[model samples]
Target: MGVRVIGPLDAAGLDVALAPFLNAQEPTAAPYVGALVDRGWVAPTDAGTYVLTQEGVETHAKLLERIQIQRAAVTAGLTDDDYRTLLDLLQRVSANVDAFASTLR
Candidate 1:
């Protein structure tokens, strides 16, 4: 899924906004921003920032709705306890992978 823009933002601001969600640095995020600009999902401002076009906003909403539906479908029949256990296991797997990656570095 593409990044969602809430308002007008510069590249540096976008990098920061996306960091937690994407683990992306400015250089990485900038290209995606450019792609959005090219797609007409976002427009460059006179001030050298970008703002979502009306179409972008609508598309983002639809994307979010689709994600919600997918999440619901994936978690169907799972109780709260089951969900928590799944999350915990996923976190453990992520941690293990991070540890192994650190070794390679």
Candidate 2:
């Protein structure tokens, strides 16, 4: 997703390329991707590939970077508020995943 989403700006293609990375049975991923598009972060090109608008792309990059930093902080054994923050973020991320899944269904 990081790689595919950045280059060419194709969130749809990013999802296709990331199919193998998903935990869904039989490589399901479109629902989440479609939900993302439906949510307005990406727009489809006539060729069927979607690109993030300038604002979406920038915002997505910032979010991805923050998530990476958070994961790294957890992996590095951060504790106290850092640990709690990570846990909080994990809960939010889980909820988002669930919400996205609901859209797919």
After superposition, candidate 2 runs with Cα above 4 Å error: 1-15, 23-26, 77-105
lDDT, residue 47, model 2:
72
Q: Report the Cα lDDT for residue 65, model 1.
A: 89
Q: Write the per-residue lDDT of candidate 2 for residues 1-105, one digit (tens) a residue.
A: 354434453555576677546655545556776776787877778876767777777878899899988888656867669878988998799879977997998
lDDT of each: 0.80, 0.71
Residue 38, candidate 1: C-alpha displacement in angstroms: 1.1
Can you list the residue pairs that collide in candidate 2? none
As a whole number from 0 to 100, the lDDT of residue 87 in candidate 2 is: 81
Reference-based TM-score of each model = 0.70, 0.51
Q: Best candidate, lDDT-wise? A: 1
Tens-place lDDT digits, model 1, residues 1-105: 356436577888887777744541234587888898899889999998889889988987898989988988999999989999999999899879867887886
